[model samples]
Target: MTEATATRTDAQATAPAKQTKKVHLIIERQDNPNSQPYTEEFLVDYVPGMNVIACLMAIQRNPVNKDGKPVAPVAWEMNCLEEVCGACMMVINGKPRQACSAIVDKLQQPIRLKPARTFPVVRDLVVDRSRMFEALKKIKAWIPIDGTYDLGPGPRMPERDRQWAYELSRCFTCGACVEACPNVNERSSYIGPFAISQARLFNAHPTGAMHREERLEALMGEGGIHECGNSQNCVQVCPKGIPLTTSIAAMNRQVTYYALGSWLKK
Candidate 1:
């Protein structure tokens, strides 16, 4: 082949691979807590192994819409991008989950992002998760300690029970279970699955058991375990794979016995 033709052929053979199409996202946005929500489209250069948070960062960096117009940067919460802090929780493509773990490659094209409506929308992809915290407070999901001095080593637990308790302790309070739960909507005061699971976790603790009856009583009150419709949605959407429904059932049995005991005394 001629020198010029040979060089051209080699160049053609060595041509770079076609660029990948950009990732498309339809994000539901709200200007403020009381403002109406609207959908906005964004396109970001596709990157290998990128997660939803990466896509959001791209949009944040550019703050441009699909139509090439500049806009306000989207607002969302995230911490410990490793998914431990549970601050990155949001509804991705209609499922409540952690955005940090939702890999872009696995997500469908034109992925939809929205705040979990189970909580009040703060803005854009941010939601007010205070209610879940309030529920936790209501149930007193904690071990009481005077903290005046070192209490020394606490009581021990059986190996099997400790292992199971460890699993329950994985809860990061992401509120994914609450968002998935139908019983936890605005019309109801349901304390939610994570709270129930947390109550169970603490109640099983050697030191925390001191307030077991109090937690059980909270679970038995209005907007308590009885409010659960048993739709089983909480367990399905939990990012930590916490056995929320199982906790609910166990707490239910405990509440039942507590009620019977209280009635007998009366």
Candidate 2:
């Protein structure tokens, strides 16, 4: 062969081969609440703009693992395909967040998925978030306006309060705060930071404030604000950036005053 052709052939032979890109997922799955947990590895074709949920959907479509064996499709929950619903929250890479928003490109290789430890695992990535909801119910996290109808617009809150209240209203009970909070584990009855912040949200409303005492009363009971360990993990994991710790302090003051007033009136 000619020298130039020989050099070209040598260079082409030494060049690295193009690698096929694929996403690696290490997911912890459970068949049932009482079932033993197991890990499954999955590999899906990498596509730009794909998120963790998208990767999981790809696996679901195929139901095959990294070993090329057919298996039960990994079970999980998702709604709205947006962050608002908070249905797909899980421990992604050791942080609890919405899977729909977990962009595969932004995540590190061998992305890990597990059910959040704060709640009971239903199956796979699905968890029972009912504890957080129960806390909401315990705090009466809603305004009541049903007597004989014609309640109309109720009352208006001051602009200053309304501005901050709007921020608090963004909470969709996503439970990220609860999941990150160390105080909200199996041993403690802490209502979680989200509930405390939610109590503040409704209490600031003019109409909602009318039932403020009731909410505060609930906050003073078991699984109330007093159970907070002040670890401040809730604020770090909250997707909405809600001022959870500040709300906790605010509610603490309310509870303190509430307890004092109750004693004085007796």
Candidate 3:
């Protein structure tokens, strides 16, 4: 070969091999409730239809970093990979969502994962969702039954109301709505949107209507319905697409009527 051609061939051979595209994952992790949080980077093999949970599992199997150093396996919560169970909710790429449904293909490069900061981080991507359930208790988000005995075919619901009620019933207490809500932070006891929607759900039930006044009254109190700032972030993030803001507005109207009714009674 000519000297010039040989030089060009050698230069081409010496060129660095193009690094294969790897799935870069940066996870925010904490060892315990009181420990300082840290970030860990992991490069996992990319796979089609892979979700956050799958990536987490890959890390768990190898527990290695991008530098190929051995590390601790990632910890997270998951159930019903279909997103029906909200146990897998975490902040993925700056948005709170179900890890099982957060497909890697749809996420940005260097997928960032973090525990939902709106709640106490238990460890890694797992968070204590007890506050959400506690809010449910605060709102008494259920229909009270007189007894466990057979109450044959309880009061019927109108077809139209049932249609809307079905939408509210889809909430799995996933905590995504609460995580997405700015008003539900440490500074506020707003009880978040899910509880309010639950209250609306139960309140619409014919039998549940008996406690409608009580639910409304609870919502009227401190950390009640009025705390909602109407950011409307909850609706956008809810996997089930539960109409949260609509429930807030509907409950607001109901509470207003209940307040006026109580005044008339007085």
TM-score (C-alpha) between model 1 and the true structure: 0.92
Which stretch of 10 consecutive residues in model 1 shows the poorest summed lDDT?
Answer: 12-21
Model 3 Cα lDDT, one tens digit per residue, 1-266? 69999999887787657334468999999999889999999999887889989999999999999888998899999989998989999999999999999999999979999999888989998899998888888888888876768777788899999999999999998888888888887788888999899999999999999888888888988799989999999999999999999999999999889899899999
Which pairs in model 1 have colliding backbones? none
Clashing pairs in 3: none
Of candidates 3 and 2, the better by TM-score = 2
Q: Count the backbone clashes (under 3 Å) in each candidate.
A: 0, 0, 0
Which is better, 1 or 3, measured by lDDT? 1
Task: Name the TM-score of candidate 2.
Answer: 0.92
Candidate 3 has an lDDT of: 0.90
Considering every candidate listed, which one attains the maximal lDDT?
Answer: 1
Rank candidates by TM-score, best first: 2, 1, 3
Q: After aligning candidate 3 to the native by TM-score, how far in Å is the CA of 239 from where it should be?
A: 1.2
